[model samples]
Each structure stands twice: as structure tokens, then as C-alpha cells.
Target: MAAAAPAGDDAVAVDVAGVVKSFPGVEALKGIDARILRGRLTGLVGPDGAGKTTLMRLMAGLMAPDAGTIRLAGVDVSHDRDRVAPSIGYMPQRFGLYEDLSVIENLRLYARLRGIAPRRAQPVFERLLGFTRLGPFTSRLAGRLSGGMKQKLGLACALMGTPGVLLLDEPGVGVDPVSRQDLWRMVEALTGEGMAVVWSTAYLDEAERCETVLLLNEGRLEYDGPPAGLTARLHDRSFRLAGPRRDRRQVLSEALGLPGVSDGVIQGDAVRLVLREGGTPDLLAPFAAETGARVEAVTPRFEDAFIDLLGGGPGGTSRLAERMDPVRLETEVTVSCRHLTRRFGTFTATEDVSFEVSRGEIFGLLGPNGAGKSTTFKMLCGLLRPSAGAAEVAGLDLRRATSEAKRQLGYMAQKFSLYGLLSVRQNLEFSAGVYGLEGRVRRARVEEMIETFQLGRHLTGAPGDLPLGYRQRLALACALMHRPPVLFLDEPTSGVDPITRREFWTHINGLVRKGVTVMVTTHFMDEAEYCDRVALMYRSKLIALDTPDALKARVVTRDLPEPTMEDAFIGLIEAHDADREAGA
Candidate 1:
């Protein structure tokens, strides 16, 4: 592999021309062409099955395109990938390191693979540890590290020999804002040193950080240039539509259905809106009178531009939610945790965490990874017994009546937790029977789920064979087969494209409208805004609990008048650290 660009080649580090990749039943990429130069960060973003991963793999020299050619550092990758392997650093989406090894061990192992001598690697190890702030955790097992720590360690490994080109695939998928910031800092620093980095991310905000962007959709290049060009299209078209905080869902639903509207979502107590061409506040006049809909123009974002570039937003209406029956409960309290604690040996995973969710409420549990949120979720879902205190679901005791309590809720895991070998129809049937549906009832429910989730065509295939969106649909269908009153979603939309996430939330919001209580654990700070109330966990304990707007308000100051959810999150954590330092 060539370390530097060829003479008079415009410093193009990666030259991709007319690239095409196809599967048995699908074409992942079609005639894609892009030039990524040295010392620049390029963002690759697209929808599910939109050829994002395929394009990334092709760019990394891991796969040869069915047609066209890719040149890495003046070398044709298809002709000689091995010749260029030493010049490229690629961090894949899954398991980039050994979980059983320690942080330092992973780095050393990669150093060995890259043939860096032990004495020379020592200084590199120290520098990377300082850069990633992982110096103190070098001896910690990779599996014991938090989500953010693991990503930072993976990035450190990828930079072992200081490769001239780097490809990161969804590195921040399930990482928290704090950790994501760290990862971005490292990538930006590398780019400053003349590294050409291609970052593929689901987070549109992250995409906007790149100097150039290659937007793909349906196997075609939709846009290729500065992200600002796309955002400029949305100038003066974004706004904040506010009413009663309690009516946020209803207001957003109505606003999304109005004519001349392009997009609408609940942000804090208001609906962040984007209007169609020639549309104005005048278009919102219909609902202004009754709901006192206040409108204030706001700056548009990269996500707005991305949505516009692809298509208009997925409408607020949900077909699947329309078919569900309203949940009926005698008590107001749907889920309750009182002084709940969990421990393994002497390590406390969760300590004295207490929260209550009411009927029809969307309760969000959020924190940095390893903050005990997962442990709390497991306790509430009846997967783990709390070392102390009480847990309840639909007024049934989760601690004592684990089976009965489990029957009251539908649990959808972050990984979609489907049986890999089982066909879609088989999985649905198994779920139906497990939930106690029988004979005609079981068959009828399975068929209804298939129709509602649009899984009929994919019935014969395993869930993994489907695209990410369809896999999510199947998982949700399996969870909701029995029509439980409560839903437990663990990062249900993590790593999914914006459109699929909007569709998922539409169904969730619709379910709440029909009286279904939801308890969700999410890494997405923006999604946390959708909750009626949120519980923020830290250091195995509850730190803050409030409405989204209230949480943001606590961090509001003269310098930060309009703070986002991520701002509030990072600000709150910093304040907590400051307070602890002062106390110490």
C-alpha cells in the first residue's frame, strides 16, 4: 500500500468509480462514484438496506464490487487488497476486539498484528490511552467496560500503526453522547494529521461534522457534497409548535397530518416542525385557535435536510397501532420500583433505584452505559431478582409473581433477540403459544400480527434475512402478539435510520394514546425527549427525574438559552462531577 498520494493525483486517497454490489435478491449498491481526499472526514449515511454497509465494506477493501473499481492510495483494491491492507484501518460494526482480554491487551494484540515492536508500541499505547482517557482502565476486561469505553478502545486499536486511511462503521450506534464526543475528538485529531477517514453513522448530527458527505438511497447516490448544502434548503422552514405539555403527542400527531407540512416531532413540550415549499405559519392557522398553538421560527438541522433529500417524513399515522385494543387497567400505577437494588458478589449494579410509571405514560430510563439502567430493566422485566426492595408490573409483584408480572408486558430487546434459525412464521407461532393463545385464537393472532407488521411476504425466511427495518418489525410483532398492557423496549430504534425510527415512534405514540404504558431504555438522547417523564441514572443510583423540558431547564443559563437534550445530559453529568469533587 502506498502511504501518500501519487504525484499530480489531487491527493485523492480513495477513488471509487461506478461501483456495484448485489446479493441474491437485492442490489445493495448501484454505479456509485465518489472521491475522498486526504486530510478530510467523509460521512456515509443512508437508510436501512440502502447499501451503507455494503459501500463501507467495499471502501474498506473487505469486499470486491460486482462491477466497477476502487483505488486505495493509487492501488486497485480489487486487484491487490493485501498490498493495501497495511495502509488502511477499518473498525467494523461488531466485536472489533476480544471481550475476554483487557483494554491494554487488545491494543497490544493489534500492535502485534500490525508488526509494531514492543518497545516502540509502549509510547503509542501511552499516547492512545491519554487520547481516549482510558489510562486507568487498561487492565479492565473489555467485557466489563462501558459501551463508550469499548468504542474508544476499539478506535485505539484501529490506529495501531497510524494507517493513512480509516473506515469507521456505526461506531456510535449505541454509545452515549459523552462517549460519542470522545470518539469524534479522536477522529478529528487523526484527520488533522492528514488521515482520510470515512465515518458511517446513523446519527445525522455526527454526519454533519464531516467535511464531505456521500448520501446513498435505494442503491443510488442521492447527494454528494457539503452537508450545509442540504441544510440550506431548509432555511426559514423549521419552527417550534407548542401547546400544553400533556398534549404534546396529540399536537404532533395533528401537526404531522396538516397540509403543507414536511416534518413534525415532539421536542420537549413543543413539536419541532419543518414545512413544505411555500408553506408558512398560515398553514397552521387551523389548529392555532383551539390549542393556542404558538409558533416560533427555528433553525433547521442536518436531519431535516437528510429527510428532505430522501423524501418527506413518514406521516404520523400508524396502521399497526390502529388495530390494537385500548389497554384496560383498574389501577393508575402501571410499573413501580421501590428501593430496588441488584448485586453480583460485592459489586453493586443497581442501588436503591425508585421510579413509578402511570397508566399510558412513556417512562424513559437513561444513563451512560454501566450506570445500572440495564440491571434495573432486567429487574422490571422479571429477568433478574432484585437483591432488595419491590418491583411491580400492572399491579402484579415482579419480585414474587415473576411469571404473572411478565405476562402483563411485552419486552423487545435491543438486539431484536429473535431465534436466528427459526422462520418468521415459526417465531410468531412460538410466541403466540408462549403467551397462552390457543387453537383458533393462536392462528388468528399470528395471522393478524403478520398482516399488521407486513411480514406475510417474509414469512418463509429467518428474521436475520430481512433488512434491519423488517427485523425490527418482526421483533415488535412477536412482543405484541398477546396485546400486553405494558411495553418494555430496550434501545428499540438504536442504529436504525431516521425514517424507520419515526415509524417506530409513531406506533409507540399511538399505543400510548390507546392507553398502553411504556418503559423504555434508550441511548439516543433525542428519543429521550419523547418520554412523559425520564429517570436519569448514574453511579448505580438515581440522579435526576423530571419531564424533558424540566431537565433541560435545570441546565439553562445566560450563555445557553436554547439547550438540546444532549446539552442537558452532558451539562448535568458535569455538574454532578463538580459537586462530587467539591465534596471530596
Candidate 2:
């Protein structure tokens, strides 16, 4: 085991030493040692199955470590959770909020659970509502709130008793950018007020904002330090290449094949690449000249360093991509929405949404929570009836030929829709049967999916038992079992690691090369770069429509750094909101 950095009287909130935890067939954590200091935010960052949640649970006293000692505020509380419970607050990934209760009602309930008297809880609840910007929605039912609002409410509930330490597990996984900003602002204020916070997040960008970061891989700690120090190691090792937009795949393939190149991704009209140690600009000159692409050195971000530290390389060939039989349809318009609108009673979920997806195109719907992206998606998939207008899939009207249109495509919901009780192979077999496959064909398809997704060993394992990455793979495999022409992916990579995300997109790109149309909705702004075009939605309306580069150009200026998709997205939404207010 490596020697952990000395805590050195820095007001350590939690001290974990030589901790090891195990499940029936897995060692969840192995010899972990770290010190979380008060008044500082510590980011727990790693790939799926890296034991982030397990570590958090241990610190929260929800679970005991099989070995080693955990000290909470200088007191050993590894087995005495009752002694530590009063000083610790834990907000799990799926926070427990009463759906039937209003926001303020839920807060009062949690306060009561914590044994706070009404006299004291009222002031705290009011302050929390203001802090979370949820004061306006105090009367709204928790279940009716958007994903971001629910997370804020959860955080407020966790803070009811003013615990000295806070542990958040992937709190921003599916949250929109604006809400993410709000959440971080609140967290920073808490840390400023001398609260120790340990946050686990899949987004490396979020980790970059932390005062300290703990990097883990497969249950072992890899690095413990400031985010800047980790990113500094990759200085001069990262570069951006700009070339013909259509040559993205070719450039990525060639770049990955280059010596010393570690990993690369499509980044909105450019490819961001990370090179191994001792890699030089001269090494890339040949490829640059061949592709007529311009290469420029760029500062590496926290994500680049994280991927490099994990030894992530170019994604291997995707077997799933190989088995994807391209769509043979002769139509140019694969998906079309003409002023599609949906309403739930008096509430308009989506309105006047119009867009067309071309064959083999990757179309993305980008928006904030409650921005009607999912409602639009459901309309296109024929799951919901549009209050107005029409949509077509594979030239079949969604309303008139709903069954036929659905039969021509595959749909994966925002949540993993697979049966938790069924084995991996069983889910695949069931999916094949739903698509009307039988006999030897069903068996062959299931086996092919297992082999393609590398789920051979987990054939008998339940889907819910798999890691986040593997579960995503299984979901995608099941969605493609029948080889549909169009695929709908709803937040397909939520809570997944960067490595797995890269690998998943590699397969998607390959399938696109073979002419498959994909309509995807995602919260990860970086993933928007992979789309041929993206539509930005705000308050049940399409606010902007264009390629990622064009949308970004709307916000980019000489005085500011190059705008990311998130920046552009926020800018567009804010502008639209301002316009609506002015019109009103």
C-alpha cells in the first residue's frame, strides 16, 4: 500500500486508513487511505466499479469496512454509527423523497425524522428553500418537480440537521447545466462555512472545481492531490486537430493508430487527443499533412489527465458494430417532426417542435430539465400522443402507423428498462422474441449480442447486478438485437465512466458508418459534439437548431475563451428566457 499524505492537523473531518471492503464475489475497496479536511470539498472521481459509492457509504457509517479504521472527527466510528450519525449527512444517488408530499412538506418530514422541533425546523426550512432557489416551488409536489429540483430538495433535506460532514454520491449525474451550477454554488457556500463535503461524480469537469480530488480505479486509490497538479502532468501532451468535418472518423482512426497516442474524441469540428509520454509534435506532422488538418497545442483538462492515469487507450473494434446490418431503406428522411406538440391537461410539455433527421445522422436533443426533450422524444417514438402536429419514422406516420413505425426502430429509455430479475441472456432472448425472432435465429442473435457486448461471463447474471458500464452495454445490445434502422438512446451514458462512454460512442459511430440513424438525448454537453446537428430546447420549445459548432459560435467572442457546448447551451437558454420575459 502507498503512504497517504499526512493530515497534519488540518481539521480532518474524516480519516480513512488501510480500508478494505468486499462483497460475495468482489473486493469493493482495497487498502484505501485518505484524509478529508473540513472546509474543503473533496471529489471522489473514478470509473464505474471503482468503489466510490462503497467508500462514501463507509464514511457515512451506513456500512462497515471489512478491515481498517475510519475516524469521524477524531473518533473511531467504524462500527458505532449511532455516535457518528448526528455529525454526518449522506445524500445517496437516488435520494429518498416522498413523492406524495410537497417540497416544504418533504423538508418538514425529514426535519421531523431528524428530531428537530417545529420551532427550529421552520427557520431552517425557509433558509434551505432560499438557498436551493426552491422557495417558489414550496407547494409543488416532489414527484412533479424536475430532476434538478428534486436533487436540490434532496440536498436541502440532507442539510436539515446541519451535519458537520456531507457525502454526496453522483448528485449531478442527470442534472442540467444550469441546475448543476446552482448546486455547486450551494456546495461551495457550505464548504466556505466550514463544512466538509465529499462529492462523488462521474463528470471530470465537476471534479476540476474541487479543492482536493481522490482518484480511484477498480477499488484502489491511484492519486490523491489537487486537480491542477494532476492536469499539469499532461501539459504539452494534448493537442487539438481541426479538419474537414466529414473526415472526423478517418482522423480519429488514424490518430488512435499513431504511436504514443493514448486516446482521442470528436470535439465539435475538431478532435481532442492525448498523447503518451515523450510524444512530440513532429510525430503528428505526417498525419496532419496527409489529412490537411491543422494541429494546435492545447491545455489538458482534468478529464485528459484522468483518462491518461487510468491507462485508457483507443477503443478496440466493436463486435456489436460488426453485427449491425445497416438500414436498407431508400428514404432520405428517416425521422421528421412537424410542429409536434404535447400537453398534459392544461400543461404544455412540448410545443411547436419541428425537426428532420437524415439517414445515418446522429441527432441530439439538448436542454435543461423539464425542457420537454423527453416529451418530444416520446412523441417521435409514438409513446405519447402529440396534442398537435404530426411525426414520421421511417416514412410511416407515428399516429397513423404507430405499430409499423415502432417496428422499424429500437428504443432505450432514460432508465435501464431491462428486467432486474432476468439474466443477461434471458433479457436478450426476451427482446428478440418481442421483435418476432424465433428458433435458431433467436438463439444466434442472443449469443451474438453476448459476444459483441463481452457479456459472455455474465450470461446468467442479472442485469441489475452488473457494473454501470456493463449495464449500459447490455441495454444497448438489447436495443439492437433486431437490427432496427433507427435507434433512440435516452441519456444512454448517464453515470457511466469516460472510458466506457468513449467505447460506446465508437460503436455508435461505426453503426452510423453502416447507415443507422440515431436520435439521442443526453445531459453530457461534450457528447453533443458527436451529433451531426443538435436542437436546443427550453421551456417546452425549441430555442435553437444547428450544428454544435454553429451553436457555439453564437456565444464565442475574442475576449473569451472558446465556448463549450455547455456555455452555448446555457447562453441560448438564458437568452430565450429573457426574450420571453420581455415579451410578457
Candidate 3:
């Protein structure tokens, strides 16, 4: 913070000049310079370990930069932190909300921390509760709220002082489409009212919505301007090639190898491609000719531009595909749930949930947080004992042979659930031992995973100390040490960067081709496209189960004839809620 503003049109909320920050082993920021404006939205967009969080913390005065200065609303944070503290609101990745406290209680606690009296805080509290639509659940404990509600509460707490500059770091992480949309609208409205908002996110789509974008990567600023500056680079380079679902994956694999095809991914029944500078629409003809697929040029998205900036996504090849053994199972259906129910005392988490997954298929479990997706997932993983009915894994009854059923699959929890104290190598060894691998077999698999996931350099470091992407790699490796026939991934790419996400899916698609079955839960609706079929849960019930295309078809209307996965998700949930209200 400096000494007060220069006045009217030149109102700089936060000004950074030649800022540099370094940690023990890595330089987090390098000579960064930018000017944040009042009443404007500035998005901090970058990959994992690219200094988004570091920048947010530095601006919040949580830490002083090794070099340079950050002036907040005309006051220097490094020199006058106490004086400027009340002018800024900061929410880190994990917002500090007490699990045992009620929604209203958390807000009051924050107001007290900000030194606001109850009489003065009441009007602000009322406005926030009404704005976030959390008034009815004021008495609900923070721990009992859904992921979306928790985020809303976090934002409300941050705004307790009604600060001039608001910094939100990945507030939408682990939040579903409907909730993410709501969060975006809330932040946008804040910017409209003269609050300088800096929103950091792993999702590129969110960045594209910002009025101004500050793109950082590896301690350096790549671009600082409107999002259009990046998307314009990939102009006329993006295209969609549509074909039979069976042929698209194969065609995408082949298309990636073609001259000038920089990036390609399986999106619904088509392969979305991003071409290089010299690449042209003519390059897609060869792949389209054989499958009789239709090709049309599509506008490039911020993701396409982002991957291009990162030197393109990983190649569509998987080492696991070359090494992992084939699926060997007794039955075609590897997982089955028949009238499954789970209850915590009198409250039902999941009620009469049922589903089946065939061998080698990619089945998706999708829903908003606390919508029974996790309840159903836990029952399938044998982590929870169902209140009624039964399930089977690899032809083994979960109720009768829980241990045997557990042995048939590998589980990667949402948070990765790794032993943070153990070194990478130690974690791998421990995981192998848990799966009952012998000496030589265990050693070979450990080394194999290290090499496959490029974890050779970080062998001695604790998995928790690594970046979010590397930690994800180690988690997946630990889970797959025994090479189980079935894999259960719970929101595996929730906060991962787009580049790493592509690489993760490359391994997944490769495994599926070799006959390994997969059941995944994800908040990113785009990820639902990877599944063969999706089971959507809402308020402890399975409301829709079908292929991704079919689910989108259900929500089609004249206004939204071409609905995205996100569109289908929110639409179905709304229609279901409307029906429930009508019946009630």
C-alpha cells in the first residue's frame, strides 16, 4: 500500500513494480509488474507451480517479496501492513472456515477478527447472506454444508470488512458446474461495484471470462492484457472433426502425428484439434477421408491458446499401455450395485442407488458435492458399509467378501490421500507392500512407476512438498502399484492444470484400451465426455444414467440445441428440483 490514490480515472488498486519472490529451492516470481484497477476483474491464470498462489499471498501481505514492492490502494504493504490490512480481503485455496461452526457463526467470527462490532456488522451480514442465498441454512454447521456452500461462506467471510481489493485463490476448485457458475456471477458483481477482484483459477474457461488477464508461468509473466490477445494467436487454427465414437479416438491418435497438428483431444463424438502456425485445414483431410468423418473449423478457446503457450500438451502415448497387463476377469460386468443405501444415523447419504460397470469400460459418477456421488463411490470402494442391499466387484460380493472385493481395484481419493511425511520412494514401497507384492516384483514396479511418471528426480522429497501435478502423479502411481483390473478415481483432476490433465487422461485412455475398467467422479463437466456412460446423483438419488450425448440430448431446447456437458448438468438438476417442489 502507498499513501492514498492519485484520484479518479487513474485509480490503481494494487501496483506492482519489479516484484521477485524466492523460496528454499525455487524462485516463485521474477520481476513481475502490473497495475490492478478499481471496479475491474483481473484474473491470475497459470499452470501449477506457476506462482499464482505465491502472488496472491504476497499481495495479501502474508509474506514480503525477496525483491520489489506491492502497493495496495496507495499504501506499501511491506512498510505499512497494519494500516492497509483492513483494505484487502484474501481467501486462500483452502478458505479458513471452522468445520464445527455454523454458517452465521463463521461470518461473525470473521467480522470480529476484522474488528467490526456486531451492530455495525449486522447489515453487512444480512446483505451477504441474501446475496449468497445462504439465509435459510444460517444454522447449519460449516462441515455439514456442501462444497459450493462452503465456498460461498468463505467469500462472505472475506467480504466481512467490505474491502476495496478482494483476492480469491481457486474458489471454484472441487465445485460443480452450477456452483461454479454461481461463484463467477458473485465475483463479477463485486467487480461491477468498484471492488478490485483478483480471481485465480486452474480452469482456463474461467480466465477467459475476466476483463483483464494476467498470465504467469514458471516465475515469469507471459502476458498481461485482455484474454483476446492469447485466443487471437490460435485464430483459424482450431477445428472439429466428427466421426463415429469408435473411430474418433483412433483418428485423434493418428491426427496428433500428422504434420502441424499441435493438439487434439476427444470431445464428445469429435476430435477437437489445435494446429501449429504452418498447419492448415487441409491437414485434417487424410484422417477424415478414411472414417468419412466431417470436419469444420471451430473458434479457438483460451485452453487451446494456453496449451500452445505451454509448448503444447503431452503426446497421446502411454507407457502404461506398453507395460500393464491385460484385464483378466471372470465376468463381463466388473462392478455392480443393487439397491445400495448408506446412512449416517438418521440422515441418508445415498438411497437405493444402483449401477453396473462392464469390464474395460470408463464409467463416470458425477454430481455436485454432497450429492451422494461420494456416498455411492465409497460403497463401491468398500470404504463404507451400506445400510441395505449389496454390491459386487470382480464377481466378489462386497457384503460377504469385502476384503476380496477391495483387492480387485485401485483407489485414488479426491485429495490423493498420500502419506505426506514419507518420501516418494518410501510411499511407493509402502503402497506395494499394502497390495502384497513380493520383493523383486515390488522393486521392479516401484522403479517402473518412478520412470513412467517422471518422478526420478523427486524420489527423496515428500509427496506433499511437490507441486499439485507431481503429487497427482505419485498418488496415481501408488494406487496402481499392484496393477488392479479396475481403477476408481475420485475427482483426479479437480485442481490440476490443463497440460497435466491431458497427460493424466493419456495414461487413463491407454489403460482403458488394455482392458482396465475405470470409474471416476469429477466436477469438470468436460471430463464427463471421457466416460462410456455417466450416472448422475442428486440429493441422495440417481436421477440420470446414460451416455454423455444422451444426457445432453435430454436438455436440448430451441435456445440451447447444442448443449455442453455443463448445460446438461445444471439443466437436469434444475428440472429435478422443480419437479420435487411441484410434488411437495
Each prediction's TM-score versus the true structure? 0.96, 0.97, 0.96
- In the range 93-175, model 1's lDDT, one tens digit per residue, is 88478999999999999999999999899999998899899999999999989889999999888887888888898899889
Model 2 segments more than 4 A misplaced = 1-10, 314-316
Q: Give lDDT: candidate 2, residue 184.
A: 96
RMSD of each: 2.1, 3.1, 2.2
Give per-residue CA lDDT, model 3, range 1-584, as digits (tens). Answer: 11233467567899998999999889999999998988888989898899999999999999999999999867889889999999999999988999999999999999999999988988889999988889999999999999999999999998888898999999889999888888988987887777889999888888888988999999999999999988999989999987644555566667777878888888877889999887888887777777688788988998899888888878788887769878888899999999999999999999998888999889999998888887788889999999998999899998889998888899999866999889999999999999999889989999999998889989999987888889999999988898889999999988888988988888888888888899999998888888889999998999999999899999999999989899999999999999999999
lDDT tens digits by residue: candidate 2, 1-584: 11122346857888999999999889999999999988889999999889999999899888888999999867777777788787888999879999999998999899998889988888888888999999999999999999999999999999888888889999998899999999999998898888899999999989999999999999999999999999999989999888744468657866887877988889988888898888887788778878888889988999999999998554645667777666788799999999999999999999999999999999999899999999998889999999999999999998889988988899988978999989988899899999999999899988888877789988899998898889999999888888888999999999898998988888888888788999999999999999999999888989899999999999887875689999998888888878889999
Please identify which of the two predictions, 1 or 2, would achieve the higher lDDT against the true structure: 2
Clashing pairs in 1: none
Name the weakest run of 10 consecutive residues (lDDT summed) in model 2.
Answer: 1-10
Order the candidates by lDDT, highest first: 2, 3, 1
lDDT of 3 at 63: 93
